[model samples]
Target: MTEGETPAQVGASSVDIKDVDVIAPNFKKRLSGVTSTIVQLVPYQMKLGIRIATLGPGLPAYLPHIRWTGLFGLWRPPVGRRHRIWHARRNNEMLAGLILKYVLSMPLKLIFTSAAQRHHSSYTRWLIRRMDAVAATNSRSGGFLQVEHTVIRHGVDLDLFHPPQAQDDTIAATGLPGTLLVGCFGRVRHQKGTDLFVKAMIELLPQYPDWTAVISGRITPENKGFADSLKAGIAKAGLERRIVFLGEVDDIRPWYRRLDLYVAPSRNEGFGLTPLEAMASQTAVVASDAGAYAEMIVEGETGACVPAGDYGALRDAICTYLAAPSLAALHGKAGLRHARDTFALENEARSLNRLYEALIG
Candidate 1:
């Protein structure tokens, strides 16, 4: 058993509240980008002997974590520490930290990582002011913050997402048609611009018969009708077989490896990571100018970026690669190099650890 694991708690390493130096709270029940980051990062932080543990749901079974009941024990500081750091990614989590520190008088230092690229609401601005420290995923997000913040770009796990060991074999296993693959992976919604990708593919794929387009992600209940309409459009264009949708993939790393090019067509995002993930997988990307995508891709060098929600620009940008497969391959190699040097997951963990150490000290 780990430091705090009891006989009743079956899965996950539950760290003792007293021993924890940092508390990373994931309040959301759904699987979001924030939740995914906490899951991937906590284990890395623990391996570095940071004594950080996750709090709340949506995490895997093996990462270090504390039960919700552990909140009761927060009144006292952890052993060998003046106060424990409460690291929050979302507003609700930040609010909870404020409550714990101000209302409950817990020995906690509040830290909030802001990824949003929009103007903060009055409520959000008020909350950010109370934080002991802040982190912005990129420069633009930092610009949106009224308070000072450290800019730390999110990164991908290069080990998990890398150049395909056997690209042809991986592609064949998927049973998807075509020699070259273009994919858009995320939730299917208008804001995500799934329709724009589909429209671009409809117009482009028929000319380039060897290239297939894949859409892999979940279509939530509210967006089911929207997804259905896209399918209908695909069918009308007689490109049903050419364009595939693999819904809610279990492990997306392999899927990234199989692609020649990846598309992130979201109209808006909170520090998008798919382009970085695709870049790490040695896949060229054509992402929209959303989130931190413009900062990620080097235009013609690694990949191309189109104006968000611009159908004509999206189509033209994709056609640039479809017209020349060699260019995509060349960009893919450069993307791999860039991802390795600038966006390794270890880099993100180490950066965050440095921030945590400052606060904890």
Candidate 2:
């Protein structure tokens, strides 16, 4: 067994631990973007009978996962293959896989998926260099990588996130005020442009009294003061009732459906998924030119794309849709069609499976 792994720690049943084709490792205990990707993708892969299993902490128990003790079994040849695929999305996972393949002599083929848009450090570059094959979430991300890699954009689960049957009833059920709703959902922080979203709402909500705005996300301890400051600003404008802060919610799908227009004003991102989620929910989006948002959004069709960190441009984009509700509805319908036709979750799973098959062959 690997260091720190004991027989008593093996959580998987003996039957569940055997004959795994792909080992998706998530080392972080916290739920992050990387962890979310694993959580979404693995189940779909398993549904296709891929024999995939996750290795690490934090994933939901419902997902098929083996414990640390399962690492010992990797020393032997995988069923019907010389090596199994170790898909790592983080630096630590790659390092662990490197040790298992080289130091411990496990029959494993390493695959690293990168979503970072910025330059990589020397250490990260070295780890990436050792990978047998690499996958980038977008074309821009692939350009930043020094090594050759396939560009595999992320896809949303169309079944889970879709247009609501009754939009008004859905919003009224939540008990949030306003006939019309627009939202910016994600972690409330400067980098995420949460403040900009609030500022834009303050300026615009007064003219459109029938409409309201919402911010749904967490504010960490360090950013608690920042959040308080936004609340203070909203109170100062006397628009607290109109612009609501839901904080964090368990399921964000309902929130997306309730929104007539969705805004992702992030200053930076690593393949942001919020816009895609909104689109899949048949909500028109106004996203900043961050991450792969521009790639995902079709200007004037699916949604509008604004310059990052420009609140004025963001304000104007929101106004354009607010003034023309029909245009907004048209965009929403187009977005739904675009999301289903282009970004289906099954497509991504099948593509990855093809890659795995090619590598194994």
> Which candidate number would show the highest lDDT if scored against the true structure?
1
Give me the runs in candidate 1 sitting further than 4 Å from their true place.
1-12, 167-169
Instruction: List, residue by residue over 262-306, the lDDT tens digit for candidate 1.
Output: 999999999988999899888999999999999999989999998
Please give, for residues 1-361, the per-residue lDDT of candidate 2 as tens digits.
Answer: 4432223223533334458978999999988899988878876787776878888888876667777887888888667888799999999999999999999999889999999999999999999999999999998889899998998999998867888777442567767676778999999999999999999999988888768899999999999999999999999999999889998998788889988899999999999999989999999999999999999999999999999998899999999988887888899999999999999888889989988988886
Give each model's clash number. 0, 0
Give the Cα lDDT of each candidate: 0.88, 0.88
Which TM-score value belongs to model 1?
0.95
Candidate 2 versus the native: TM-score?
0.95
Error of 1 at 226 (Å): 1.0
